[model samples]
Target: MEFWKNCWNCGHDTPQERVALEFFPRIVEMFSKKEDGKVNQRVWAVFYDSYSFTKCKKCSAPSLFVDEYWTQTTSPEEAKCIAEEVKINGVSKSGNLVHSHIYPGFLKEPFPQWTHDLEETYMVLFWEVYQAAALGLNSLAMMGIRAIIDKFALDKIGDIGGFAKKLNTLLNAKIINADQHALLEVVVDAGNASAHRGYKPDNNHVKICLQIIEQLIGIEKFGDVINEIRQATPKRT
Candidate 1:
């Protein structure tokens, strides 16, 4: 079977193929102690424990992962049935499993290399907010995005009044087009809602907001940075 996983070496999503694998069902017996200081078996949990050696097809980087599956409390008979099934059939593809990297330790989502080209303070804050989003701190991450926009506007066109006013100035100055301006308004308003209105955005929403921010920072400037520059330059009469 093939699985798509983030390649630790290449920092890309790639298909992984299992090279060496072994799995077996094991049962853990839970014990409870009575008032008489006597211990008695209370319940049993059965699961399949396995070590999968997989290699990234794109980069050929090997990763050793320890995995556990089907962990739940069950009766002895049920545990026996599960154990027999696992022992005979091996690991099932359509099941819940936890994969932990044991060899190269842990890995984090890789950020784009171009993000480092941003101005110093914004660049640092951007990465911090990215980490916050990755860590599931949605509210803080949204607020951080809002703060970055505020700072970016300030750097672009002075204090430039409030948030809405800054966006207007950007539009009037032709820094951002109608569509890009509209998208920024949506994200900035959502950021405000997330900050002051107790609105918590989902991961999908955060992802979209991040994508917009990325586009704005890129050379394209969400549309055409070069055209915007031409618009800024005084045309020969």
Candidate 2:
């Protein structure tokens, strides 16, 4: 008997053993086809309660966790719509996904706007990291070391001097190596010159700064972080 086998998501016929369906009608449709013997199939199943966990590329620690799954359906459009709607609803209910980490001082503002800004900063940081990894130091250095620090996690250190001290401490603890340490110093000096002394960083310096960050985090770890951030980032409107 010739069976009409297709992807539960897109209705695209596939030889794969299992088709993942996302909604109730799709699941019912698959079963109906099986029961009527219109299609040759052994099992019609729906994916429910599926959870995905992402691990940090550097430390291999659990970083991001998502615990929700929709019922299977035969429509890819419907599945996509459901996923997007779920994500939008989540953000509306929780403000922003990344905002969950914000504390009282800088992030505690008029709620939604504050959360949106945090999300923007996080996106920029990820872009910077990815550019550094792919294109090397030249690309990242242009943003200036101070800017990177400020954008990434420097405000948490308070003042510029304190930021420099913290970088040194990280280096000393072997959290960052010698090359990264040197790059950090250069970036701080360049940033200070630009911010306090009205001096700007040359293109070469920008490249070097990017390279330093890449070395410190490693490409694989950076990729993992980027993916996690993407997964957690909230959609606007």
Per lDDT, the best of the predicted structures is 1
Model 2 / residue 14 / CA error / Å: 46
For each candidate, what TM-score against the reference? 0.54, 0.32
The 10-residue segment of model 2 with minimum total lDDT is 99-108
Give me the runs in candidate 1 sitting further than 4 Å from their true place.
1-6, 10-53, 57-59, 64-70, 74-110, 129-141, 157-162, 169-178, 196-204, 219-237
Residue-wise C-alpha lDDT for candidate 2, range 168-219, written one tens digit per residue: 7666666667876776777767667665665655556665665665444343
Measured with C-alpha atoms, the lDDT of residue 190 in candidate 2 is 69
User: Please, what are the lDDT tens digits per residue for candidate 1 over residues 1-237?
Assistant: 567756668676678777877666777666898877699658776666666677988879998766576655444554455444434444445445654444564335666677776667877888888888977789888888888888878878999588999999999998888998999999999899998888999998988998888777675333566778889999899
Cα TM-score of candidate 1: 0.54
The global C-alpha lDDT for each of the candidates, from Candidate 1 onward, is 0.74, 0.44
Candidate 1 has its poorest 10 consecutive residues by lDDT at 82-91
